[model samples]
Target: MRRREGENREATNLNVNSLETLVTHIQVLSGNIADLTYLSNVLKQSGDWLQSEQTRLAPLLGELNPSMHSLGYLYILEAHISAPISKEQANELLLSVARFINACTAEQIHLAPEKFISVCRRFKDQVLLLDEPLRGVAPMLTALRKLQTSCEQLTALHPEFLLLCLLSKSYKTGLSILEDDIFDFDQPHDLFLYCYYGGMICIGHKRFRKALELLHNVVTAPRLIINIAAEAYKKYILVSLIHLGQFSTSFPPYTSGAARKYLKNFSQPYLALVESYDTGKISELETCVQTNKDKFESDKNLGLVKQVVSSMYKRNIQRLTRTYLTLSLQDIANRAKLNTAKEAEMHVLQMIQEGQIYATINQKDGMVRFLEDPEQYKTSEMINCIDSSIQRMMMLSKKLTTMDEMMSYDPSYIREAEKARSIFDFDDVDSLPLKPDIDAHLKDVSSSYDIDD
Candidate 1:
């Protein structure tokens, strides 16, 4: 019994020594950045020590020295970012860092804006590189907000903070930053990251056009990174189907041949599904998606692909509107490949509300009456087109007039025109055949010909 008690005392002493060593390292790192290599090593040691000692120290450490714990976490983050850590190690380090950041008071975070920003930026980079969602993103965003409140000027220094905002589902904050043009990406990867996250945010807000535009930027970047481009293409295709009912004709023209080919090869399942959708082969589309279900899930795109499938029935139903003056819900179910009449009715109601199809439903007979009068609709559309054309032409005229004013004031342009006129004059002089006699001879010939006539 005495020996066991002695062992417990020894373990307690070891824990105390470990805690003291970690505190010392954290203090040294906080005071200096001259030896980042040594600091990195010490911080890593501190992290390992903290992990082993966490259960025993959790209750007392918060009250005894919270600032020390926070600084120690900052050191661990700095070290993790500087060193080459595995994905698992990075994740674990980030989890600890996040917890520490969250535990700190807003005032504590505000007081250390630089350190907070440093940690947030590094954490954002890791999250982006791993291409996985982090659980602790909310705390990171909260800490960033506090840092921003403390030093608004420093916000611009870390544009990747917007990424953390988005990841934390802080869409309003991210959108504000995006609108303000505060994000400045210096690297190709960073640009892709911004577009990818921005597109997702747009998707969440149901801004499909803006989402497509952002994803298009990612897929069509000059230095195309395959994984990001592939993911962007998947989202682009899904969003395109949702927004335009088909891929826009203008989309392919912007993409390079290599990108197109790569997309075809890498995204064959999606391409097949799109073709089946366009051709109105509902069964084929369903089968293709089902067969590639694992692939879709692995790519994290199963939900989007399923959405495409849901939309296929709508497209088919819309096609029926063109051919039939009226379709009963049963007829729509049969023609649109829907499972039941109720499903067809729901789709038709939604389409009517969205202005995709003009129709009124009869609740009694379950009949759908098409309200579209082709001739009147055509005439109104034609008038709208004419009005739009006139507006565009007026804008074009203004633009041309402004351009002419600028050209008129350009000395180089005026000098070039004078030079061109002189050249033409010299050519005419050279072509005069060195004789007025040539002109007189031609006149005499013309007069003789007139007399002969």
Candidate 2:
């Protein structure tokens, strides 16, 4: 008992009386304290003690292999950031923490979640403060990937990581995270930010369909104010115009009343652009864009608005395909409102190259021959794609069945259902309709109808 108490006391004594002794002291602690839970609890409980020793403790954390002493390093790092530090020192710690984060053992880090969260939030700030925030992208992503228990579990880090990716123009890295279906999350705000930033990432990828879907989620998701959703709604309008070539004036029935009322007022310019785009007149679209040029530029959506114009051109050209089997480039130029035959030919060649239209352009004759789609869906790749889609649908069906079963087994749902059934159930004496000589009446009716009695 005395020996064990001695060991416990020694573990608690985090004194670095001298710079020379700091490394030796940490080594002793790591070696003597065999139980990680004990070490984790000690570090957690003594955060104040650790904070006082921050000057001595900070250096030791960098010296220790984070994988070997994750709990101690996490707690110390959390303590180190709890107080303020100079910008110069923060830059230094940013590099240090990034290194630690990459090397930290995942299993041990989970032991002190509170400390881990603190360090992560601080790290995000440190990286964002750099002159070139893009430098933070790779490390932030690595940290997020490491810290999360599962890809499905959304954390506070999710929004910051996405912001870094956006700042760095790392859309593919952002999509790698966004592609995961988040089924578990503790904060509503985190979910909102995830959808918002994730939608922007998809837009960067020119994935208009996916971008619209994600932005729509932000708009319709239940909220009291929905400022983020309102911002997402503006982007939603632009994407909807580009992708669907039309926009609905009304919000869906499920959208919060606050969104429907205020969103339109805030984004009136974008809404007007929608109106002009619906005209299918390139001149009107261009005019609306020029009129709202300042607002779109301020919102950093000037580029996206330009894509809407190009999409309109493509849409106009595609319409011509339905009408004429073959048309000279000059006729296409006239009908599509393009300036010249060369411009029309450029559009045709690009569309054909993208497989957006099945057409052959005769360069010598300055004519385009639109043809029927050639895909017969007989290739092995097509078969595999179709089979995969069916499998996914089957999986979704099974998931829905499982969720329904789980809901049926919920205590609250079961209780409410029982209450409803009991309240609606009728008693024989009180509620049953009185039928005097019902059997005789039935027999008489049957005889009257010439049925066998």
Write one digit per residue (lDDT tens) for candidate 1, span 147-259.
Answer: 55432122522335545544455556556544433222334455555676677667656577888888888777655656556767877887888777787433456565456
Which segments of model 2 are wrong by more than 4 Å? Answer: 1-34, 400-453
Query: Each model's TM-score, in the order given?
Result: 0.52, 0.82
Q: Top TM-score: which candidate number?
A: 2
Worst 10 residues of 2 by lDDT: 426-435
C-alpha lDDT of candidate 2 relative to the true structure: 0.73
lDDT of 1 at 63: 38
Candidate 2 structure quality by residue, lDDT tens digits, 1-453: 979976765655554344345444444455433556555655555666667876666666656667777766777677777777777777887887788788887777777766777787777666655545576777777777777898768876787777766666678888988877676777766677678778888888777788888888878775523445556787899789877878898988877666666678879899899889989999999999999999877665777788788878889999988899999999999988999999888888888987789999888988789999999999999999999999988977887788789989999989977885889632111111122322332232222221110
- In candidate 1, position 4 carries an lDDT of 92
Poorest 10 consecutive residues of model 1 by lDDT?
A: 444-453
lDDT for each candidate structure: 0.61, 0.73
